[model samples]
Target: MSTIERKTVVLTGASGGIGMATAKALTERGFEVIAVVRDPSRVRDVGAVFQADLANLADVVRVGRELAEKVPRIDVLINNAGLHAFSQRTTVDGLPVMVAVNHVAPFLLTHALLPKLRASRGRIVHVASDAHRRVTTLSLPDDLVRTAQFSARESSFLYAQSKLLGVLFTKALARRLNGTGVVANSCCPGLNVTGLGRESRTFAALAKVLAAVGAFSPASGARIVVRLAADPESGSTSGTHFSRDGSVKVDTTLVANVALQEQLWAETARLPAVSSLGDFR
Candidate 1:
């Protein structure tokens, strides 16, 4: 009898609603779940949980190196951690918090663990959003790192722009990993009563109302992520955005621009958080 080998998935934000749901579903399916959480004390019943603040690049680099050193092999990486805000704020690293967590941190971590992913012929699933379509214009690489004064409404647009970057990053990463058997894709899990908007009381109240009135459950919202991460058919579905119906579509016109994607990749490589690590590009 041939023994079956359990597949391992590294998931960020595994302590939250959608993430906790993904962890449960994967474990039940016999996948070893390695959770990258903001607080280990809040995480339970995963294979292993490593705590790190995604808003901080130094911590991201530290944890990425640790995973690369210790995890041996990774069959999938789910960049599910994210944040939304009604106000603009910068991190200690001098980058916008939304941009740092939603895009750059995942980019750095994925690159740092590229070797393990390649060894396993793994998949990369970014938890992006359809919100990207809401963005009207972006200044490219410049808008990625710089944040200026903006109203609450403008902040929402800024958040949308950050998610747009995630979509673009997925496409760019897929291009970079071509012929390497390490595929990358992204999905927009429909809004659920998650902690993504805890920064604002109004949004939190609105989310509760939406959840009560038939918003998708965290488990249901997690379906797209689970599919993109573990579905055999999804292994080859790179450089696309998946909706709730499993339909493939471009997240936005900006994400579809190859030139913009390449520019984003090059500029992302130049980010202080990534470039300071030396030659990961």
Candidate 2:
């Protein structure tokens, strides 16, 4: 039997929970791991660690450039960084915090690294969630970037909308990269007990309680992500959304809108920082 050589993977959101666990799991399998995090001090071990706050487009550009300069090729790129805000917030770029962090940043980073990924015939894994089913609409109003007063219900709804965008983006990206020897797919990690809910004490408590009952461990939740990144079976699968167990999952109706996906791709490309990167597709 021939032993397959492990490949290099670039993973974001590595300072905590699912991302942290996934980093360790990939390392254990002998893959070269380039873990990206907001806080460099928080990462304990990895092949390499890069720091950048995903909410900032400039920071995303900086991190992308830095990675491009240092790493010659990337076999896999995992877009795992995310934020669940209980209230509305805006970034320095004036975009809604959750949308910027969960979608735009990942979009920019992935596009910026596409050349290297293409060179290696890499795969891109986007971590999505079932919560996206709750998003009934996809609207990017003129003032959508502004932070507005939000009820608890509205906050969750908006968060789901962001995840839905992720699913749509993954599909669109896969199509754009077709026949390039690169594949992109999205997956839901399920309800894992992660610090993602750190903003709410109640949520944190509930996560801890559920984790105690074996609802899901960060390690277990990270399996699909690791599998997609390393498993040979997934090499040819692109534009599909998957569940925790590696089964196919359909995106919500709102997310399945191809027109909306193209609109988002064009609008995202219009962003000053994103535009500066030149033609990514």
Candidate 3:
């Protein structure tokens, strides 16, 4: 089968695991892979790499402007950078670390790149997770940002909620990009033993056990994202969620209420991190 030529893809979280695997896979397949990462020294052999810490909103803006100036167009944007913090932490902008890293940073980056993406008729792939289903409620209280108390269990729940917000953000962005050539979709990569949890020793051991038991490898986990970015058929699919196998998947509660999604979008927009982006359509 013939493949697309000169395709450009910007992927966050490329320092390791699924992100690193995806960067290699895409580059080997003839796509120009731009690896967005925080530590440049850790990345090796990626086609092109940029360093930016997504936890900082100012860095997000600076990186966005720098990327826009450097790249003429972006054929695909993969919002794969994420954090699974086991404690409460805040960014320089004062937003929760999980929320900032997982959602707001990608939101700002994608918004800043929209014009370039539209010019290339690009696709957006958000590496969300089925863990979103674990979030008991979508409402984030005003004090949620202020409270610093957190346990590992509570942090897991918050991380899941951040992923849920990613799903909603994808939906809202798709609607906003309607009539443009850009398409947006989110997906769950299934359980993967990709060393994504190296931050905690317990998680690292669990990741190893999961790998032994047949949880997908990082390469397998990245397949859906690669497919969404490079497969011609995916050009027509937008505003939907998918599983690792590329099948449509949705949380029933999330799909049932467009109003909730919109409200979430508005609320997220009001977040200081996102609001500071300055008129992102």
Candidate 4:
């Protein structure tokens, strides 16, 4: 008897939340799971772990390049790490913390490892959210660089806007990757039982109560992500929004607006943080 080789999956935020559960599921499915985490000590039972604090753009870039260099055959790249701050916070780069971690870091990492992904024809899955609808309007170019202090109550709308940007990025990236054999898609993992500690103590306690009632378990939340990332049936799928269900794509003006998506892509590429990385596909 011989041990079978597993596909490579580079997952961010694997130390906790849906990412941790997704890491477990992907491992069980016979994929070699490589975790890109902020704290390496916190990660366990994965094939390997790479450290990168997504809130810091420089660290993300460095780690992204490292992963691209080290992980020779990446079959799936899941930009699954994200954060929700009730009170406004900014990264060292002066960008909003949520925007920096959720959107910008993933964008940079994807670009950094794109060559490997293209070579392997891998799948890219982003954990997005339905809260995008909470934001009725999106100000492009400006939103990409917008920085402001937001209250806890107002953070939801800002968080919604950030996920909306992910949807837009998926649309644009799928277009760029049309002939490259790399597929890109985003999904809302639903409200989950894990990752509550990062938000606040109140939410953490709420999560415990929710879990006691058997609601939003991590495995169930990670199912669609696992399917989108490794399922052969999903290989050709791109630019689709997997909302509560992948069979029914989520409909959002932001997701469908190609012109807006294109604009967002261009502006993101031109951002000082991203542009400093040089021209990226």
lDDT of 1 at 246: 88
Please report how far candidate 1 places residue 13 from its true position, in Å: 0.6
RMSD of each: 1.8, 2.2, 2.3, 1.8
Q: How well is each residue in 131-193 modelled by candidate 4, as lDDT tens digits?
A: 886777888677766677777778778888998888888888999999889999988888888
Candidate 4's C-alpha runs over 4 A off are: 1-5
Q: Per-candidate TM vs. native? A: 0.95, 0.93, 0.92, 0.95
User: Candidate 4's C-alpha lDDT?
Assistant: 0.84
Model 3: which residue pairs collide?
A: none
lDDT of 3 by residue, 1-281 (tens): 24545888999998888898889899888888888899999898777788899999889888888888898778999999988888888788888888888888888898778888999889999999888877666655452265476888687788888888888889888988888988999998877777556767899999888778877788899998889888889998889889888787545686446787787767767776667768653
lDDT of each: 0.87, 0.86, 0.83, 0.84
Superior by lDDT: candidate 1 or candidate 2: 1
lDDT at position 29, candidate 2: 85
Per-residue lDDT value at 272 in model 2: 56
**Using alpha carbons, what is the TM-score of model 1?**
0.95
- Global CA lDDT computed for model 1: 0.87
After TM-score superposition, what is the CA distance of residue 251 in candidate 4 from its true location, in Å? 2.3
Worst 10 residues of 3 by lDDT: 138-147
RMSD of 1: 1.8
**Least well predicted 10-residue stretch by lDDT in candidate 4:** 244-253
What residue pairs clash in candidate 2, if any at all?
A: none
